[model samples]
Target: MYETIKWPDEMKPSRSPIHFTNELDVAASVETIWSLLTDPKAWPSFYPGVQHVQLLDGHARFGAGTRFETNLAGQDVHASVQEFEPMTRIAWGGYPKAAEHSRAYHAWIITPTANGCHLWTEETMRGPHWIELAKQAPDIYWLTHEKLLKDIAEVAVAREKSGA
Candidate 1:
């Protein structure tokens, strides 16, 4: 079971990027998954931890130069579309400015397989304060991310069953 889910290296004291991949056997097609993944408006509905999200003056269609904002973990995170491929991948760098203890870049890639789909979330972090913060909070990031993944997978399955 553990082999199926992998966390990024950044979760460790080394402060590297965290890479996680999970495959789900959704009955939905690639287009269905792509629509849900790219739409910021649908996020809070699927991912409960997301307090709010706003599209910041960009078209919702996938492409370069797209931007959006989200209230994640009580932090107002600003992210821009670094890469956007319809029905395939979307990447963004978060927290544009370098804050004292936090920095992140997150990306999601969606691939259609014979059975269902492959979804992956990659997050990279940089900052000397990460280890200290982790020591104090202990798995805050890990738990939050794990929940997000679970929520996404659950919603996808539901959508598939509903013929969405």
Candidate 2:
């Protein structure tokens, strides 16, 4: 029995002040979408803002408790999996090494649909300098996520067709 996980207070849009959410109706199974979402290394290939991902613990697929680091949107982020639900959701949060105390939480939720599934991704950024950073580059907050979701859908569809 899968249940929707409650959003942590820190990750809540109202609590964070700077938040963004993007959803995509993908023509792929929840498992397929989940696989792509869990693969950190593959992210840079499709997500423009991501430069690299290095796993500090666990394998290429991140599960609960897995720790990793990434260069996202020109920020060095050290993150660990805070929550994971197979084929349903995964969320992570950590501070950007580039910034003194800036922190970010990103989550993905997949819900089964008649044709396929609905993929929703949201992110929240908070800290003393977060607002200034958001003001400096607001596009990274939402636009990149939209592109990432689109890319994931295309990959999932292709993988399904090839029977991979």
Q: Each prediction's Cα lDDT score? A: 0.63, 0.81
Q: What is every candidate's alpha-carbon RMSD to the true fold? A: 5.1, 2.6
Give the per-residue lDDT digits (tens) of candidate 1, residues 1-164.
22222323443324563333334455556777777777787788766568677777857654566777786655677777776777877767666333535666566667687877776665555564444456677666666666776777777778888777
TM-score computed on alpha carbons, candidate 1? 0.74
Model 1's lDDT to the true fold?
0.63
Runs of candidate 2 exceeding 4 Å displacement:
1-5
Compose the digit string of candidate 2's lDDT tens values, residues 70-89.
87766788998888989888
Scored against the true structure, residue 27 in model 2 reaches a CA lDDT of 96
Model 1 misses residue 143 by how many Å? 2.7
Give the worst 10-residue stretch by lDDT in candidate 1.
1-10
lDDT of 2 at 125: 83
